[model samples]
Target: MTQNCFDDGDEDDVPEWADRVMADVAREVRRRRKEMKWSAQDLADRCEAIGFPIPRNVIANMESGRRAVLPLVEVMVLAEALYTHPIRLIYPVGYVEEVQQLPLTYPVDTAQAMSWFAGLNEDFRADHRMLRHHVAHRTAVERAFFAVHSEERQRRAAESTVDDIEQAKALRTQADLAERTARAKAELYQVRSDIYADGDPLPDLPDELVDVDPPEGYERDTD
Candidate 1:
């Protein structure tokens, strides 16, 4: 329910709150544009290159705080134009330590809000299924991708730096150990992902994981 203000006869706070949020966004957009040496026209051109075609006048209005409400699509295109993640513009994480999560709500830590927005953690009031979904998918993604990707990099580094035989051998051994750990995690991720993939034998995985099958007859002893 909107509380009516006594003097102005305003019944809604959302418009004011929304304008404040957009002011923050405008400040950020202008800062990023200036940092990258882009004028309003340049920023607009980048948006056009991204196929959204936000006109220079629109960019001017947004950056000048004349526009308060931006569509979600504009947020995405602006982030890409500025070479930033959408969430960074959505919530100014480093610029402010806390943010009002919503109008009339107490401020929460920016990191907490970011994590909640990213589906990295559960809200107490969130649906139980979604909570489980985030956890399971996050675990599966990390297990299926992280170690294997790191080890692959290490292996490539080892291959390229073969000038020192002993050093190269040490790096390869480290990579082999990491690969063993990756195999264990990938097997577990497959089990956990069945609920998502409806028991498909080959659950969807990152391309790197697809190419990272354990060598045949290679025992995976982590000891």
Candidate 2:
């Protein structure tokens, strides 16, 4: 005979793995609080300053895992109160080597797990081309931005130095930094072009760099 779906009575229940993950979160919160040398009351007060006002008793219960559910709002507020990224609180990178990501799955490497959570890592990146392109494109953008910014500061230092020897050194370094900046910007352009070819939304290039294309003779870094 066919069975009614509701007769099973398990469909509406929260999974056992969810509670385990919640307990992990609770433990991490307590660890961070202790590391900061703050009582539950102190954490509550900090939350109040941020206008979210989690009570001391509530925080204590949460840390004790008596609060079975943690709202995303509270996660964000607690992260702010603890002066850390929400990702770090959830994944505890550098504090743990692996994380149980799902009910039946084996633990995943902590760093890779965190990257997956952030949509920046995938087990089969080659099969998901946009995500792969995004990772490369993002790294190139950051490198180009920092290279240009560094060259700006170096140029300023070269112009302002009163000592002749220091000024010469600054100018030499600025010239080298400028070459690196050009190379980085060149790479960013090529990555961006590849992203566009893949039909993804155009990367949000910095306004100052929107017009800079790859230099005519420079080979873009493939990796």
Candidate 3:
């Protein structure tokens, strides 16, 4: 179905991939312009001179989705204008159910079409093996990407597990140190209490005590 523009009613029926595919196309087009350092007006003027006559706002709206579902021929023309491969603009990320409707020819040039069809047939038959090889190569690339991503995720999980173990060890060490501190403080308090008892030799010091003594060399060495 050729939709000039998508309406609100058709919003639900628009495949979830529509927005993403449109956005990707727009982004690539924009990126091409940026890479060439061309302003929107510059591109528009060039296209106009070449008989395409695209306006800056038209390009902007298309990219911004105010205009949606650009025709494939227009996309190819844009690719030519941008000096990029048409396939780059049309390559689908995942499964894309796309249909291109070509205008019907009346009083058709059967000879030309037949010639083109013959060439296509020859190409298919001649390059079938090479085409299969490329397809296998693409599948391998996709599988490798998946495997790399999976390995990265597994590595992160392993690192997280190690971190958790380290944190637990640190916590255990802290608890042990705290317990030792409390015990030492309690023992010192007991010593102070004993000193302050009626039959004890000296007065007890405060529970929170700071032992202050001169340097060890303060006392003469007894031989």
Evaluate all candidate structures by whole-model CA lDDT and list the values in order.
0.69, 0.79, 0.52
| Worst 10-residue lDDT window, candidate 1 | 1-10
Which stretches of candidate 1 lie above 4 Å from their native place? 1-11, 124-182, 185-203, 207-223
Model 2 earns a TM-score of: 0.73
| Winning candidate number (TM-score) | 2
Q: What value of lDDT does candidate 3 attain over all alpha carbons?
A: 0.52
Model 3: runs farther than 4 Å from truth? Answer: 1-14, 92-223
Name the runs in model 2 displaced over 4 angstroms.
1-14, 93-99, 106-124, 161-169, 213-223
Candidate that would win on lDDT? 2
> What's the TM-score of every candidate structure?
0.66, 0.73, 0.36
Better of 1 and 3 by TM-score: 1
For candidate 3, list the clashing residue pairs, or say none: none
Backbone clash numbers for all candidates listed: 0, 0, 0
lDDT of 2 by residue, 1-223 (tens): 1111121234332365576567667778899999999999999999999999999999999988788788889989999999998888788877766765655555677777788787764466867888788889889988998998999999999999999999999999999999999999888888877776666776677866766655452343356
